[model samples]
Target: MDKNTTDTPTEYYDVLIIGAGISGIAAAHHLQEQCPDKSFAILEAKESFGGTWLTHKYPGVRSDSDLHTFGYRFKPWTGAPIATGDEILAYMKSVIDDDGLQPHIRYQHTVESASWSSEENLWTITARRSDTGQSLRFKTHFLWMCQGYYQHAEGYTPQWQSMSSFKGQIIHPQTWPEDLETAGKKIVVIGSGATAATLIPALAGKCAHVTMLQRSPTWFTTGRNANAMAEELRLLDIDESWVHEITRRKVLRDQALFVQRTKEEPEKVKSDLLAVLREHLGNDFDIDTHFTPRYRPWQQRVAFIPEGDLFKAVREGLASVVTDEIDSFTTHGIQLKSGKHLDADIIVTATGFNLSVLGDISFTIDGEPLNFGDTITYRGMMFTGLPNMVWVFGYFRASWTLRSDMVGDFVCKLLKHMDANNARKVTTELRPEDEGMTLGPWIHPEDFNPGYLARGMHLLPKQGNKREWQHTHDYWLDKDDFPAIDLNDPIFSYAR
Candidate 1:
C-alpha cells in the first residue's frame, strides 16, 4: 500500500525479485525463512498484489484448479476446493502479512530493463515508478523473475467484422467495467475456455439468458466446491496439517491418473466425460455438438465446473451453448455463420490471453541484447547462458504453486551454495558437447495447445533433448529430481 521508503542513495540487495505476484511472494517467503541473512526486494508493476487473481474481476471468476495443491505448501488452505478471486487474493494477502513482506514490496515499480555486468558480478536494474514518473535504479547479485508469463496490458480479442456498429455493451473479462449492469439482459459469451465457463454460470442468475458461443467444444470436468475428504478428516478429529497432506496427495494422484488415461485411452476418457455431461443435462441436450472436442483431454487444460454449476445453469434453461462461427456483429447482436442471429444486450469476449515472458522486460548481458528464443531453458526455471538469474515457471498439468514453491526453495539452495563456496557468480550455459543435442520448443508442439502459449511460443526459451535442459510437467517427477539436481553440473560455470 505504501511506496518503497528506502532512504539509501543507491539501494543494493542480494536479490531483486520482479513482480509481486504469487511467485514473487513465495520467493520472498523462502528467502526470509531459508536464507535469513540475505537482503532482497520485490518490485511489482501493479498497484496491488495477487497478480492474476487480483487482475481479473469478472462475474464468477474463480480458480480452475483446487486450492489445496494450488496453495503454498507452507500455508494451509481452509476454504473450499475451488475459490473465488477475492478468496484467493485474501489468501495471498494473508501470506504477505504473516511473512512480514510488506516492507520489501515496492508497488508501482515496473522493471523496464536489466543489464548484467560480468566485471562487477551484479545486475543493474532500471525501473520506472508509475505514480511519480521517475526512474529508479537498483543493483543486485541475483535477479529472480516472478512476473507471470503473460502480457498484462491486454487480452487477446480477435477483430470481428463490424464490431464497432454493435449497440450492445462489449466486455472483456480481463478488464470488466466496474459499474456495467447485466441484470435482466441477454448476454453472449464468446470462447469455450475456463473464463467463459466461469462467466456463464455466474451471470445466468441475473441475466435473462446467457449463451456460450464457441467455435468448437472443450473438455470439462465436474467437481464439488467443498472437499469431502477434508470434511471427513475433520469429523474424525484429524489435524489440519494431516488433512491438507492427505487431500493434496489424493488430488495429485487423481489428476495424474486422469492425465495418464487421457494419453493412453483418450476415447475412454472422452466417453466418461460425456457420460457425466449427459447425466447432468439429460438425454435432450446436444452433447456431441457442445461438449465433445476433437483433441484429446489434457492437450488443452480441462475446465472444471464447481459442483456442476455450469451444467445446472444449462439444464435449468438459464444458460445454453451454441457451437458456431461468427460471421459478424450485427446492430442488435451477433450474426452467426449458421444463418442465425443471437440477440443480446451485452457481449462478453472471454477469448484468451496474450502470453509473454518476464513481463516483456528487456534484458542485456555485457552490452549484448538477449533474445530469449535463441537461448535454451535450463531446468525450466533458468535460461541457458543466463547468469545469476532464475525465472519462476510452474507446471501446466498441476497446481501452479506446486512448482513455484519448489523454484523458491531451489533458488535459496543456489544462493547458499554460492555463499558457502565464496562464489560471486553462477551461470548455466549450453556446453560444447551438448551443442549436438536436439533442440525443441519449450513446450512440445503436440503436447499442449492453449491459445496463449501457441500464440507466443516463438518468443519463449527453448528446451533440449537431454533431461537437464527440459522441463518436466509432472509434479511427482520434479519433486524427486529438482531438489537433488547436482549443483556442480558441468553445464553450470562458476566464477569468483
Candidate 2:
C-alpha cells in the first residue's frame, strides 16, 4: 500500500501513469472505470495535482482554449468558457476528489529514466524524489506518459545579445515569482504568443505601462467569455452532463468549420480577424502595422483575447505594441532592430515553451540507449519498437483533453484485451505494406508551425505518410476511426 521508500525493493503495478495533469487524471479515471482489477500509480513531479495549471502562476493566467472541450468528457464545465488557473485547479480537484484518486498519486517523484526488458516484458522506471533526493524504482507492464509536452522547470528565454547588460529583472511567465513587485512599474513583454497576449492585459492597469514587443505580429481571435449554447441548455433545466455534451459538440462543429475555412478561404478568415482587431483598436491605431501577422489564421495558435481585453488596454493607452526584432539588450531595456529602443523597469519573456521529449526521461531497451527519432509514431499515441506504452500527445487545433480522453479509452481497452488473451507484451511496427512509405517530421510544418514545436521537432518521433502512422489530430475523423481500430491488425505484434 505504501509508495516507494528508502530505495526499497521495486514496487510493481499493472500501469504507471507519468503525470497527474489533465490527461493523466483522465487516464487514471478510465483505468478505474474499465480495468478496476489493475494496480496503478500516478507519479507527479509537482507537490500537488494539476500539471499545467499548477506550474503556471502568472497574473490573468487562464485557459486559452474553452473549458467545455478542455475539461474531461465525463465532467461538466458550467463556468465561463475561458477559466482562470485557480478555477481550472478547482475543476481538477473536484474530479480527483470525486474519483478518490489522491491515494494513487505520488507527488515529487521525478522520473529520471526508464529501461525496457524484453525477456521480462516489463519497464523498470527510476525516479528521483524532489523532497528527499531519494531514488526510487518501479516495474510496470504499461507506461502512460501524460507528463505534457513542454519543459515545466524553466520557460524558454531566448539568448538575446548583451542580456547581461540589462539592469532590470527578466521574468518568464512559467515561473512567475509571487513576491516580485509589479505595481507602477514600466514593463516590456516580448513575443505575441498566448502567454504574452494573456499577460499584457493582466499587468496593464496595475503597472505604470506595458509594451508588447514582438519580432512579428501574430493572428488573434477575440470574443465574449460566455458560451450561449451552454447557458441556453442550463435554462432548460437539463442534466448538467447532457448540457455539457451538447455544448461541447456545438463548439467542436464550429471549430471544424472555422478550421476548414482557414484552409479554403484564408483571405476571408484574415479579413475577419483584422476587422475584429480594428473594432477594438479603431481606425486611428495602425492596425496593419502592429496587428497583422505574416501567417494565415491557425498557422500558429490563435490566442483568445476574451472581450478584446488586451486590445482594450491598447485603446486605453495603458499598453502598446512594438513589432520589431531585438538587436540586443541595453542597460535600460531592449535595443530594437529598427534603430529604436524600448526602456522598461521589467522585461517578461512571454516567449513560449521548450518542448520535452518523453518527459526528458532517458530510455534504454535491454541496456542499450533508445532514440525516439529512430522510431515512427503509430497514430501519434504509440511508437514503433516501444511496447505497452501510450503517450497523450493531444490536438493542436482542438482541445488537448479530447485526444487524451480518446487515448485513455484506447489504452484501457488494450489492457483488457491483453488480459483476455493472456498476453504480456504488445508493440507496433510498420507492416510490409509500409515498406515504401515516406517518413517525415512529427508534424508537417506547413500545416502548423508554432515556435515551440518547430524547435523540438528533432527530439520527437518521426511520422509516416500513412494514416495510421501519424497523429491525425483530426478529432472529427479520429472520433469514429479510433473505436474501430483492429487490435489484431498486422501492424501489431503481440507476445505472451
On TM-score, the candidate that comes out on top is 2
Which pairs of residues collide in candidate 1? Answer: none
Which has the greatest lDDT?
2
The lDDT per prediction is 0.90, 0.93
lDDT of 2 by residue, 324-370 (tens): 89999999999999999999999999999999989999999889998
Q: Model 2: how far is 451 from its true place, Å? A: 1.2
In candidate 2, the residue pairs with backbone N, CA or C atoms under 3 Å apart (3 or more residues apart, or in different chains) clash, namely none
Give me the runs in candidate 1 sitting further than 4 Å from their true place.
1-8
Q: Each prediction's Cα RMSD?
A: 2.3, 1.9
Model 2 clash number: 0
